[model samples]
Target: MRNILTFLQESNDTAGAAHLLKTSAAPVTGSSGLSGKEIFAQTCVACHSADGKGAFPGVPDFTDKNGRLSKPDSELFKHVMGGFQSPGSPMAMPPKGGNTSLTDTDIQNVIKYLHEEFGS
Candidate 1:
């Protein structure tokens, strides 16, 4: 997760981080020390999708360099931790993606994987 933060700072000086935090998962409870990819697949894929393109409108696409991935890790963490209400969207992301069993480490790992997979 720290790597993600440094990368964001180095990448573009975090121009639209507030928006990312505002845009930022599920209850599969990938709590068995799941890898980031596994967690994302089990939980986030329903929305963010495996290709990093959002599965639906209003969801931010990670493949977009200027989109959600541009945000710092802290903001991303807060976004995920608290869940977010995308303006005007009918649904909101639940905290811990509603898993309730995921530790903070799990989220960190998932974030790292997200960057590695899509930050390019």
Candidate 2:
């Protein structure tokens, strides 16, 4: 298993995360060579939680079949890249999950990871 401490040490906030993610060692391809899972781990796990169940009350549960994944991948991509506020949710999704350095491919890869690992 990847160490959470490494991720935290590399990035403590959104901007830091973005910088670290862009400069981190290569892992896969199309996203600085980092796999979707690695990007998610380094950039997303902070708010979405390790299991993708979300850390805060208003955070959408990626694990729910009827939740965020229910939307089309394109919609998810837009929301992730541009950010969104669910009508009834208390918290809003930050653009690129606050990691501005995330490329389109990186976002897409993270989305793919969410679907494959947490989607119902």
Candidate 3:
């Protein structure tokens, strides 16, 4: 019975190895071991656009030569996590860029992506 169980486990491992070899999984990249560009597209592009250019009138264009990320990382992090709920601006940055589940590391990774794609 033990030998049978061992054989089954080995077979499962071999099948998994074969599947991994046959299938394609893009390697993780960028800071935080995630695709920052992909996360931005999924979470931020609604306001920041695919190229990090702000789409709405109130949203600040990240691609601008003078953008918010040019500020210190601390400032950017506060804005992203706490959100901007000031008066006169209809759209405030939702906490954690609206993904409340994102960790500080994830937010930092997004900031890194912004620096790479938009910052001077």
Over 1-120, each residue of candidate 3 has an lDDT whose tens digit, in order, gives 122123324645443234334433333233244566766765566556566666445667777676676788888888888876435544466666556556788888888888998876
Which residue pairs does candidate 2 place in steric collision? 28-33
Top candidate (TM-score): 1
**lDDT pick, better of 1 and 3:** 1
Off by over 4 Å in 1: 1-32
User: In what order do the candidates fall by lDDT, top score first?
Assistant: 2, 1, 3
Better of 1 and 2 by TM-score: 1
In angstroms, give how far residue 81 of model 1 lies from its true place.
Answer: 1.0
Higher-scoring candidate on TM-score, 1 or 3: 1
Candidate 2 lDDT, tens digit per residue, 1-120?
123224434434344344344444333233456778988876676657778887656668888888888999999999988888777765566677666668998888888888889865
State in Å the error of residue 108, model 2: 0.8
Query: In lDDT terms, which candidate is top?
Result: 2
RMSD of each: 12.1, 7.3, 15.3
lDDT of all predictions, in order shown? 0.67, 0.69, 0.61
- What TM-score against the true fold does each predicted structure earn? 0.72, 0.71, 0.66
Question: Clashes in each model (backbone N, CA, C under 3 Å)?
Answer: 3, 1, 0
Off-target runs (Cα >4 Å) in candidate 2 are 1-31
